[model samples]
Structure formats: C-alpha cells, structure tokens
Target: MAVFFDAIGQGGSDGHPFYDSQRTEHKHVANGGDIAVLAGISYSVTDLALGPWIIWDSTLGDLTRKVSYGGVDMQPIGVIQWGGTAPGAVDAWTEVFALAGVPAGEAQVVAAVWGGMNSQRALRCQTVSYTGVHSIGTPIIASGVGNSAVTATATATAAGRIVGVFGTRSGMSGYNGSQRFLSNDGVGLLMGDAPGTGSPQGQTVTRQNDGPWAGLVVPLQAADTVATCEPLIVEPTISSRVHRAPRTGGLRRKVFKVPADFQ
Candidate 1:
C-alpha cells in the first residue's frame, strides 16, 4: 500500500516544535452615504444672514474626492426641512438639517458647498450645545475663527458650529454669494460649520472614480494640504513590523527543516 500521510516537520528537538502566525489589522473611515437631513426652508432671511447645513461623514477613512469651491451647485445626500415657500414669494429660503452618524474624532469637520448661489452661502460655526466631546481640532471648533484670525461675533467654543462665510453680490445683492466656508481653532484644524441649533451641514464628501463628477473630489487631498471641494481626510491603513518572518512563504503556509535521520 502507498503511504499518503502529511508531514509535520519540526524545528526544535525538545519533543515539541511549533510555528507562530497572526492576522493583520486594518483601519478605515466609515463611508457617509445617503445620510438624511433637512436643508433650507421656503422662506427668506429678513436680515440676509448666512445659512449652513450640518451633516456627518459615514466613514472616518481618508477623504477622497474632487476639490470643489464655493458657489458651485452641490447635491446633498441627506434629508432636508424647509419652511415651504414664503407668503408672497415664488422662490424662498429653506431650512436644512442632517445627522452625521459618525462620532467625534481627532480630525476636524471638513466641508464643501456650491459657491455663487443665488441666495445661499455656507459658513462654519461652533456648536452651542451637544452630547459630543470634540477635541479642540474638531471641525465645529475650527469654524469659529475669522480669516483675519480674530474671533467672529459667533464663536464655537462651548457648544457652537461654523457657517459658510464668503461671497459677493453683483445683481441680487442678498441672494447670489459664496456657499461654503472653512474654519480652524487657534490649535489649527479645519472643521464644518453650520447654522442655528439644529441645521443640516455636510462634513466631507467623496466621489465615484469612473464617473463624470470624478474630477470634483478625487485623488484625496491630504489633510495637511489646502481645502478643495473634496472632503479632506487622513486615511488609516494596516501597518506591521517583522519579529521573525519566514522568507519563503506567507504566514499561513510555512515549512520547517529537520535534522537528517532525527525521526
């Protein structure tokens, strides 16, 4: 009869020999897709104040997408709530709201929006009240500083959020303007800043690689680099160091050398 037994090659001679192996660990940001919230109402801002939409990214992985700027049209992926149309106006302001299921992290709240909209502007602001414990570098905190590095009238230290704060008007005066803004606390971290107590604001965005919108938010801008329409993020990945690796194969498949005639 032919023998077909597998060999359990040994490396040590103390009556027992073994090999060690392990699995690798990896980290990635949760993808924030199809999240819901309200954005804008059907009324008008009597004082012509800025509006902000607050939303969160699903994953905390590296932010990958196009570099969008202000005044550009953006489609939100969340539910929105507007107060309907104004009493006598055909097109009026709308109230927006959203909830980014992602918990607070070390990264700031990076966001982008359509610039030069007829009657919309994005601004970063502080959260006036929240159950979240945000680090000073979080987006909400970063949105409180003015471009001049001075404190704006609406700060976001204890419980505040940011708002879109840049834009100009050549015709409609109170309508056409910039629709996004970025802010950083004194410590240095860009964050998303929305408006009011519960407005719908977006944190960051990514796009499909093979689509037309690809150029808008792809190649993931490094968090340390400048801000574009794409969501700015620092992705996480698996890392390792060799303690003692087998040179011939992977961890799951290994072999051992035996002394001649030792068995």
Candidate 2:
C-alpha cells in the first residue's frame, strides 16, 4: 500500500499515472543531472527523488501534512496543489503533500479522498465492446453508472456518465499508454483489486442514471495556463452531518467511506 510514483530514469510508469497540468511526469527529477528521470512512487524518498504533491486532512478539523506513507484506514484526499478551504475550515497551502498514511481523529477520522483540480486524470473501465475505435478526443459518457466505467455500446457528450476521453488509441479496456494513464485509475477503482476479499466497499463510483458529476476531468492533452499556484476555493461543508462533494476548483475529490465510520 505504498502509493507508487515513477522511479528514477523513467517518465510514466504502470500502477500510478496521475498528475496535473501544473507538473508533468518529468517534474520528479532525481538529480539536477539535466537528465529528467521519473521518481515514481516507491517506499523510497530523498531530497532529489521526491515530489511537492499536496493533499488535504480533516482527520479532526486539524489539517496535517504527510509524506511517503500509505493508509490502511483512509483514502488520501487528492493532491491539494491549488489550495482550498471548507467553510469554517482552514485555507489550503501551496506545498504539495503526497497521499501518505495518517492517524485517526475523533469521529473525524480520516476517510478516502483526492481533491481534483483542472488536472489530467484517467479512469479505468472493464472490458467492454466499443462503438468502432475510440480515438483521441472521443468524448466519454456514462449511463446511470454504479461504478466508474463506460457501458456497453458507445456514448457521446452530455449523454451518460461523462468520464474523460481516450488519451491513447483504444478499442477495449485498459487503453492507457506510457504517458497515458487509464491503468492507474484501474488500480484505484479496485483499490489494488484485492482478490477473494473483494474490492473495498464504497470504492465503486455511483452515478444516478442521468445524474452528472459536476467537475472537470483534466484532459491528458491540455495546456498549462496557470500563472501561479493559488488557494483552492473549497465549498463549505454546510452541515458536518451531510458530507457533500469537496471541490478544488473544477474537480471534486471522489469520496470513499472507511468501514470503521459506518460500523
């Protein structure tokens, strides 16, 4: 459960391919050797081989930063690059925090989340028939999806679940390439696809048939237009009793519930 990133001498790797427009796969340089190597996630860390990834924490209404650790009882909130703050909450910071392991808090124990921004993100889909060949720029949608997957047959813009498009060529499931990502989402969707034990509950994405997720799926081929890193404008948690979508800017960190929270 060590959240992996690219290793040295690599750009994009398997398992974890999530990144934002603010930074590319090369941002993870090991040394200033002018050689852009990937510092993919490992149980390893160093001044030269690390990241500036940021994340959020409300484990107890107190925000804490983490590094190089994974959680068994929590799903890391998305990297909080563009800082944000929930109403009556603290403002986010510019420093990036990796999705590391965290401690529990009173009732506010950490849960799973990854605050999304206008950053590129890929989703994993089970093997399904395609409508012809899905190429780059082919818009994706979902139909009353119970989880994060495209349905049989084909879809269009504003139709069903509006997941992102194909970063690479594809006619079936798992179509991401080296620089592309769908595979990472695959692992996340299944939570490492732990066999026999079954995928963790609530790990499945739910769409209300025609219900649209009001957020942005940063495309793999978008431009970096950010002038400077700024604080994220998080929507206020109006009622602590009713936890809603936590937004960064245009993206919402998909929420996951820890079994302990319910049981």
Candidate 3:
C-alpha cells in the first residue's frame, strides 16, 4: 500500500481574448496524502467550427469541486490543419483531460475556453500519492478509437482496496503546435486480469493508444487480493530553492558627492 509521484505543474494562455483561462499549481511537501490531479490541453484556432474546452479545479477541505470536458461537437483524436488554404484546413486542436481525488493540499488545476475565439491554451498538472486505505472512483470515459486496448474495471467493496487508473485524450483536432506530451504518442498503462476471470476474482486495467492526445494511470489491489496491472509512475518528494544575500551589518554609511557634468 504505497503510491507516490508528486510535482509537475504548468500553465499557459497566449493570443489572448481576455486571457481565456489557465492554472496549474501543485505543491505538496509531504506529511499529507491521497492526491491525484492529471490534466492536459493544447489549442490554437481560427474557426473550423471551433471547439476545445476543459475546466477542472478540484479543491479539497472546504469543497469546491468541478469537472468538464470538450464541446462544440466533439470527435477528436488528433486532427490537423494549419494556415488554412489547403493543408488540412482545420485550424488547431488538442485535448487530453483528467482529474482524480485531489484532497491533499495545494492542488489547483484548471483549463478553459468558451467563447471569444483567438485562442491558445495549455495546462498540465501531475501529482499523485496514496498510502493505505484509499478510495477514489467516478470518471471512466473510455474510447481510444480503434481500441488497440482500453479497459477499466472495478469491484473493491472493502478490505484494502487500491485501484487507480487515470487517463486523458478526448476529442483532439490537429495542427501540430509542436504536439505536446501525450506520452510521446504511444500511450501505455497495464495491470492485468479481467479477460476470463482466472485469477483470484477480478480486477483489470489496460490502455495502449498510439496516436496522441493521451493519458493513463492504472493501479489496483484488493477484492480477494489478486493484483497486477500496475503502471502509475511515481517520483517526486520535494525540493524547493530560493536564496539571496548581501546585507549583514547594523551600522550606517552615508556619502554625498558632486555632479561634474554627469560623471
């Protein structure tokens, strides 16, 4: 019962139409636990019927949760078209969104773009840590197009249940604005057992997309205890730095000179 991967925050929004929206703030100095915030987005448009929206700011303690995905007729898994005329003629689009649990400390992940075109957006936040007695389920929007492999099953009524499968990549149009990290275009995450129920009951997790706009995190255990399907890379303890010095004495020193034609 140990899962940890903390630190990685990013935010962006240019070509402003009043600065659409963007936020990625992840700061956890240990002590607290149970947190998962994974988000992604990339955009640039001129209207191919324009579309791409995501908003997530899962606040904990006092409660202020929110979740939203793409719109304006969604159907994207990497689409492309640049400066109009005749290349692909779409404009630009990229979306890979995810938000889980988020109840640790300092975790603000948001992304938005509703109206007023002229867009250019980006947001990424990945911070995970869970140890002993965990529960976070409710977000399983699966569809990897051709379905090379995508599965997510759940059944852990009680008894040390640890299942974590996170994923992104929902309706992505293209223009290649440098193709932001979708796991480098061949997404993969595995934790087996759910094909014929031959193990100690049942618990499965698998994802292998080879396009772009992707996201994944699979970790399961408990429910008769027959676990595998584990690929939730964790690495991030804490390291913050900031130091500057040049003042030590408590005395005073004053000097007044002349001005010889701007010497």
Candidate 4:
C-alpha cells in the first residue's frame, strides 16, 4: 500500500482565487498497481450570505477518461418555518467517496469551488494503491463547537487499508472581501495498530494545517494489522492572515509503497 498527499490549491488570496471561481490541478503518481481508493475535501467560507461550495473532477492518463463528484454545499446553517433559523456560525463541510476500477497509470485530480460571490475556498486530496482485494469504509463525519478542531473514528474490516479525514470551519460570524478572508483550514489522519504486548495502540500518521490537504497511509499485515482508524481535524492557527504554501509551479506528486509479502 502507498499513500499520497497533496495540497491542490488555496483561494481568497493573491495567485489563489477559489472565492469567485477557480480550478486547481494535482498530479497523481502511478504505482504500477490498481488504485484502491481516492478522497478529497474543500475548505470554504462558512457565512450564510455567500453559501460555501466545493467539488472534485479527475482525468485519467492523456485525459482520455474522467470522473467527478458534483458540487457540495458546505454551509451548515438552515431555516425552517416553525424554527425560523438554526445555528448561524457554521463555516465548513467535508465528504469522502470511493472510486471504481482506475487503471494503473498516471492521472490528474482537479478541485473546484464556486457560486459564492466573494467567499474563500481551498482544496486537498489523497490517493491510495494496493495489490490485493480491499474495501473502502463508509465516510465518517464529525463536528466541533467554538473551535477549529474536529475528529471522526471508524472500524476497518480488512487489512491494508488507507484512511482519510477532511476539516473546515463552521458558522463564521464576520464576512470580509476575498482578499481579507480566512481560508487556512486543514485535514489530518491517524492509525491505530492492532493490540500487541508492549506497543502503543495509536499513532499520528500525518497532521497538517498550513496547507489545504493532509493524508495518512496504513499498511496492515494480513495477520497483525489493526481494526480501527481515526481521522482528526486541524484548524488554522492564524485567522487574520492567509497562509500561502510554496507554489508547485506545476503539478505536485508524492508516493509511498508497502512491501507485498508483508501484507
């Protein structure tokens, strides 16, 4: 098994314009094996006025084939006739989905955020590859109050599994123009190994807040892998400034490989 993490793009700032409308490209490195699963998230403004949104689109090698997840609304605020209105400070929303049989080759994942008049948006994505039969667990959702951190936990039924987590703000009170907006939300993943004599049960795989996306890869031994994993939410420390990651200049790619015999 191999895990790849990339911060596709960030909006509401110079050079990164996801507020009005924008599309960012991320390169996927091929492992010469089948793609077991893929997941992503978008961090956008949580104000009810603009109405946050996020979506993903991908193209196989040579742009011959493509797949996409329809746009997702991240706003958590809602109104009812009897209730009048619900929580008004919601800021962000996240989701994870599975992919069909994607061949072993280079590919590209594109993330887009739009429909908001002057809101900020950011995107992050992950890709996993394995050789044997594997299953993708249902996506878990978690939330927090008056804070940026959030967490979700789930049990893994099979070994050699890759877990993902995405995080964003909710119910932001103030609204600013695209240039001054806060778009620094982040995502992270953690893995817990199966019970053992002396080894610790949980370990932090990867935690990132400076960028748009973060991922963690767990290589499970068919005989000794863990049965549960946790995905944690990381919120931006600085709310006033928009953090800019080092530009990729072009597509960015990363790869991790797990030994075949071990699993």
- Predicted structure with the largest TM-score when compared to the true one: 4
User: Considering summed lDDT, which 10 consecutive residues are worst modelled in model 1?
Assistant: 212-221
lDDT of 4 by residue, 1-263 (tens): 32222122122112233344445555544443333434444333323224223332221111111224222221111111100122322333343434534455555655444444444434433333333323443443344332332333444433333343333322222211111112332312221222111221222222222222221222222222245778677765532333345456676544444333311
lDDT by candidate, in order shown: 0.20, 0.21, 0.31, 0.32
In candidate 1, position 7 carries an lDDT of: 12
lDDT of 3 at 192: 16
lDDT ranking of the models: 4, 3, 2, 1
For candidate 2, report its TM-score: 0.17
Cα lDDT over the full model 1:
0.20
**lDDT against true structure, model 3:** 0.31
Best by lDDT, which number?
4
- Model 3 residue runs over 4 Å out of place are 1-23, 32-119, 124-126, 132-215, 220-263
Superior candidate under TM-score, 1 versus 2: 1
For model 3, residues 1-263, the per-residue Cα lDDT tens digits are 33333444433233333344444333332224454433433343332223222222221121212223221111122212121232222233333344344444443444443433324433233322333324333322333333234333434333323232222232222211112223211112211112112122222223232322222222322222247788788765654444445446775444444333321
What are the per-residue Cα lDDT tens digits for candidate 2 across 1-263? 11111221222222223432111122121221111110111110111111233232222233332222122222222222111232221212112112121221211111112333332222222111111111212212212212233221222222111122221111124422122222322112111110111111111222222211111121111122356878888664332244456677886787754332221
Which residue pairs in model 4 clash with each other? 89-170, 89-171, 90-170, 90-171, 91-169, 91-170, 91-171, 92-169
Query: What digit string (tens of lDDT, one per residue) describes model 1 on residues 80-169?
Result: 112112122111111122233233222222222221213322222111112221211221211111112211122233232333221111
TM per prediction: 0.18, 0.17, 0.25, 0.43
Candidate 4 accuracy as TM-score: 0.43
Q: How far off is residue 174 in model 3, in Å? A: 29
